[model samples]
Target: MKDFPSCFGESGVQVADFSSSTSRTAQNLVSCVYQCRLRGRSRLITVSWSKNLMGQGFSVGIDDNTNQCLCKVDIKPWLFSKKKGSKSLEADSSKIDIIWDLSSAKFGSGPEPLEGFYLGIVFERRMILLLGDMRKEAFKKTSATPVPSDPIFIAKREHIFGKKIFSTKVQFCDNGQLHDLVIECDTSAVSDPCLMIRVDSQTVMQVKRLRWKFRGNNTILVDGLAVEVFWDVHNWLFGTSLGNAVFMFKTNPSAEKLWVSQPLSDPHMLPWSWSQRFQDSQSQCLGFSLILYAWKNE
Candidate 1:
């Protein structure tokens, strides 16, 4: 299974459904992809977390450098009683084991566990990725040797809900300092709504006359690096009360090259599909993409 970003690239941008997704399916869902080097080869591992009426669940998917899925497994805490269990599969001619113990996991408003749990991915008895604080428990359960080299986080997609202020914490680079990201916009309050973005409570980028600039891209500096910000608030201004908005923060590999590479015909067009870019050669230049689907409750 592939983890697709709701926001697409500009060169071949095409609109995708954001307003039609049910609140349950589109809320509290987060997926993260990691780049791991195993046996001298690079591979991607996608871990997705979600919650439903049954309880919380997650899925782990392994893909090769070519973006081909080698194996995947879904763990449902309530249904399959998978709160504490492991699964084994074959990938790259090696035995791949995914072990997890979410029975003691702690969570906040979102689906992801805050702590008190461990999820490990073992390749040929070597631990490639381990999450959560229960490292000792994870190693004891998997009996896999922890490697010195850990995987690098590549991309993430999350669903956020808010009224005027949408807030989240993010790190622009691997092992980078965490920063507070806040997106504030109240279309109804002002005669002309302005979209303001802040990093660590300091306003960095602001779009005035949001009605005309509802869909566009801008570059901002963070941690001494350039980050391209793309947003689409079309549904927020024109669609129903349940309509949602999309925003993306893409960094690494020079955001300038990524934008200049695309045709400048449509200045206000938003991204279409991140999965499509992965298939194209453009994926090599694209570094990290943070896609956020902001749902308004009003």
Candidate 2:
């Protein structure tokens, strides 16, 4: 109840509802957006990684200031012979090359690879966005020069599943230390469910009488920085048994807009408009946002 803002000016503010996000809450997916300078112009590249019965797949898209998808590519490289490959596409009349090698990539429970992989985006013979631990292999394969304009990771959205406690590790800021974030709640066990959030094994925020205050926003200090957190669990308490809850962590300095109802596609990705809002949130340079669609396994 403390440190939670209940107003924007004198009028009360409520979270916006995302068209849909429930179906994909249990899927293994991670979407990240990066901002980089291309030829002195700001650009954003979105990469989405997914894991399902068919195998692992990824998609890359380039968007300019106008929110237009200049070029995009989707690759399912899990087959034996196609584990590594390169794709060339033109965006804004500029040739762009995307390369990847997941032959030996290691993955955890989630869709994102843990290590042993290289996904590179090259432009004008220079590396713009390079991910994974295989830097040497990426540069060698791409034949691109290293420049000072590496991409800035601004936002990440992940879907996590659990029985009652959902947990993940994340970095709140660019080059910031990684911390463990955990959310715990048991709707069926109690008449009035409570919400608890912990960071690095320490309790940072908790809400009692969750049935009455099922939706709200609070601010917590992390690493000497203010982090705004918002949660909505109406579905968890009143919806079907498989309903999912929403949680978001924002690091915007002046972020008065707390995300509540609006949220996420593929059978496993967010919906069109929902995903659009997620990506659009990044274009605003709103520091970093981490949205977790926590689904209960019960």
Write down the lDDT of every candidate, Cα atoms only: 0.73, 0.73
lDDT of 2 by residue, 218-270 (tens): 99999988898878787788877656777778887674573434432111222
In model 2, what are the clashing residue pairs, if there are any?
A: 16-262, 17-262, 18-262, 18-263, 265-269, 265-270, 266-269
Whole-model lDDT, model 2: 0.73
Off by over 4 Å in 1: 1-22, 25-27, 253-286
Worst 10 residues of 1 by lDDT: 6-15
Residues forming the 10-long window of minimal summed lDDT in candidate 2? 1-10
Residues 1-298 of candidate 1 have per-residue lDDT tens digits of 2235322222211322344546435435677887787887877788888776567788787776666667777665366365888889888898998888888889988888989999899988899999899999988887889787777776887778888899888888877889999999997888789999999999999999998887788889999978888788877887777777878788864433333223212213333444555544324655677878788766
TM-score of each: 0.83, 0.84
lDDT of 2 at 203: 98
What is the lDDT for 47 in model 2? 85
